[model samples]
Target: MEILLWIIIIGLFITSFVALFFPVLPSVFAIWGGFIIYHFFLNSGELTTFFWISMVTLTAVLLLADVFTGSLAVKQFGGSKLGGRVAAISVIIGAFVYPPFGILALPFIAVIIVEYWQQEDFLSALRAAIGTLIGFLSGRLAEGIIQLIMIGWFFLIIWS
Candidate 1:
């Protein structure tokens, strides 16, 4: 049973890490869930207070990264506040409307439309759209790297 539990926990962490790329998956929650599984099943009462705090902090930081990066990217690329806001909003709506790809497509379309509406220039709008794409990709990369670090830390905790 102990071996089985450890296997499950590891599997969950791997799934959580891979899920970071998919907008629809709550990858942060998956990592947290793996921690909970460890605390309850594999080593009850073994996790330290510091571990809990670190877990929460990691989750919060990743969540903020996901929420802010797109807007920052849009603005960095000369997109207006309205364009950035639309891009961010479209991502959420896109997740519900399509799923993985929609999350990317809807934001690009929305940002371009809003940028063009504001600037009335096709090239400028396209640039902003590209920025939004870069922002979204960067956000995913950041989350994936953080998730790997967090999982590595978890393994260290368990093995050490």
Candidate 2:
């Protein structure tokens, strides 16, 4: 029974890893969940309570990093709510239409085109788009790093 549970946990970990690339899924968090649950309930290990505390804290940071990143960037670029929402939707749609690059480029391209259309000013629209992209990229990069840390924590906890 314990072995079966471990197998289930491992499967979730792999699924979450795929979410890392797939945008639509919350893969990193899933991986975090697998490690956290296993370490707390099943894995015969040391510092179980402290480990969970650190895991929970790290998970909070990981989630927040993803959420605030794009908006912060958009704000820096002087993008409005309308522009940000539109850009965000475009990114999701782009994920289906393209892939990783599609996910990444949709914001930069979509915001530029839309903002330009709305304001009829090339330079201003360009600024907003650039800001949106920069913020998004930074956040995405941070998310990747957080995911890495979480995954590392998972493995180290499991192995130890």
For 60-146, candidate 1 gives per-residue lDDT tens digits of 899899888988988888899898888878887888887778888999999889899889999999999999999998998989988
Q: Can you tell me which runs of candidate 2 are displaced by over 4 Å?
A: 1-17, 36-47
Per-prediction RMSD in angstroms?
A: 1.9, 2.8
**What is candidate 2's TM-score against the reference?**
0.79
| Top TM-score model | 1
Report every candidate's CA lDDT.
Answer: 0.84, 0.75
User: What are the per-residue Cα lDDT tens digits for candidate 2 across 1-160?
Assistant: 7887788778877776566446787666677667756766785565377767887787788778767777777777877777788777877777787787777778788898888888889888999998887776776778777767876776776667
lDDT leader: 1
Alpha carbon deviation, residue 79, candidate 2 (Å): 1.5
What total of clashing residue pairs does each candidate reach? 0, 0
